[model samples]
Target: MEPLFRLALLRPAIAQDPDRPSVELAQQTDFQRALSAASGAPDPRTGLRRVVGEYVAGPL
Candidate 1:
């Protein structure tokens, strides 16, 4: 069928080797740590909102 042929073309080809080290490295890296290190700062949108909201909310 034409649809089956199109679906086959769209499918991602998986690597034949299942135990690649690049896959392990991708899993091991902490996404949050990587983001923080790259920016040298906490994410501004969420962090800024929390800081401003705390001032408005007052001591709990």
Candidate 2:
């Protein structure tokens, strides 16, 4: 939960509106663009390492 909250703080989130019908792929932010680059996304080792590092190193 802490990691998720921290990640959310790192990027600006886009709000989805079901009422509005049109959605554009062209309107993406820098964070969204970077997230889209992930293709081989299956390494829990790296995520675990980061979490552990945060625990040991304390704050950002």
Candidate 3:
């Protein structure tokens, strides 16, 4: 979650950089895909725990 938040916060900076690599873009895309899947699961608790852990531990 922290990673997502940090990524969101850094989006403008990343976008402004024309040198951004395709691998990094792909990684972001993959993160979003995983997040989307997690969001749709019946038990959101696990996702919540992940968010909390990330918030506390500063991303993994």
Clashes per candidate (backbone, < 3 Å): 0, 0, 0
* Candidate 2: pairs in clash: none
> Model 3 — which ten-residue stretch has the worst lDDT?
22-31
lDDT of 2 at 29: 56
TM-score of each: 0.28, 0.28, 0.32
Q: Arrange candidates, best TM-score first.
A: 3, 1, 2
| Whole-model lDDT values for every prediction | 0.57, 0.60, 0.64
Q: What is the C-alpha RMSD of each candidate to the true structure, in Å?
A: 12.3, 13.3, 11.4
lDDT by residue (1-60, candidate 1, tens digit) is 699899889997666666654445334334444444545545766655555565567664
* Candidate 1 residue runs with Cα over 4 Å from true position: 1-40
The TM-score obtained by model 3 is 0.32
> What's model 1's lDDT at 20?
58
Best by TM-score: 3
Question: Ten-residue segment with the worst summed lDDT in candidate 2?
Answer: 31-40
